[model samples]
Target: MASPRDPSKRTPEIESWMNGADKLERLLDRDKFKAWGFVIYRCTYRSDSEWEEFIVRIHKRVEEYLGYYNGLDLVGSFAPTVLEDRSFEGATVISLREKFNEWAVTAIKEEQGIDPSHLWHLKNGRYRFFIMVDQEALDSVLSTPEDDIHEGFVRLVNAEWKPEELDEEELAERGGPGPEEEPLEGCTEEDVGWMKVCWGHSQMPGYLQLDGSFDWDMYYSRPPVIQSLS
Candidate 1:
């Protein structure tokens, strides 16, 4: 069996995933964009068709926002009987760009083990991602102390967003936003960590949060290209 972290298993799929992350990292390092981040949409669908529909709709919605986005990446899983309880996840990376570029489709999965230092695991089968772009929001969140738990981060990550109001009858019947609009919850401060947000840096490699436990590597060496970002 191929160990999850084995670097020798460099399949095309794995290479694609690495390239995706690297591309995003390079974009961030350029410091050309004002702000960039990702949003985690924790949703479930009744059928594969429904999931496909949602993906198509979202892809279109993202296109409509081209005036405001430089590039975006959509990734996650689709399953029948998707539930709000916990079984599926998805995220959209929106890099508010000054110039437009072709959007990339690259997905991350637990099996990839892309980052050997920190393994990705589905904790309690649930987690959330937050995209804080507002200047004030960025300042507040990025201010979180290194060792301190980020209550602000948790609150924002698990926060629910209500849609434009509907008629009383429509609202009551639909029970408010459907499964796709459900708010993320049950995540605590202990379940999250801010990754690569170094002090005094404006644009740096950023992740939603460290998704899993660590595999501390004392002698690990980053490639020369990656080290240049420091």
Candidate 2:
């Protein structure tokens, strides 16, 4: 029998490729004025260390490319191998889905002051994690220390310390806004409002039609080239 793969040993290149595809999906959604396809990057990491490094690197790169993005979020899970289990794997797709759902519920509660009993729908081999963050909530969260934000999240879920600690480090590594940083420019207030509306509507199942099925081939296929925004 083949040895189980160690998700931590996966190269950063693979994670980068997956996240690049996610960014493409988001860009396409914005370009087409669509209400769907807001691109949530998902991956399985072998260890907490690997996951921490991956999150930090992605956040730094994203900040360099786009001053600051309130929409960006991450969730991960860590599972250890059991003794005498030769076929044990560190993480599974199901565990990741659970972690994401946990995060989504907490986020929704914190932002909306209401428990999210029906916040996610997992079907068609994909999990949907949804949250509503209007401008006010976004500004408030961004102003606070990233660690505090993460701690509040952990308190909401009553989860163990492992994932909570990982999330804290990930948020800290993202750093705070730079001195020269300014809110998103170019887009008018009306545009921002529209984007929020689109995001909200898209979270409802069947409300928006995604162009293609959520299959590996469809997701990893070459994306069309677009003119550079830079």
Candidate models: Cα lDDT each: 0.28, 0.28
Model 2, span 82-144: residue lDDT tens = 112212233232343455556556644553344466333222111242222223323333344
The TM-scores of all predictions, comma-separated, are 0.23, 0.25
Query: Which residue pairs of candidate 1 clash?
Result: 70-97
Candidate 2: worst-modelled 10 consecutive residues by lDDT: 151-160
CA deviation > 4 Å runs, candidate 1: 1-27, 30-43, 67-230
TM-score of 1: 0.23
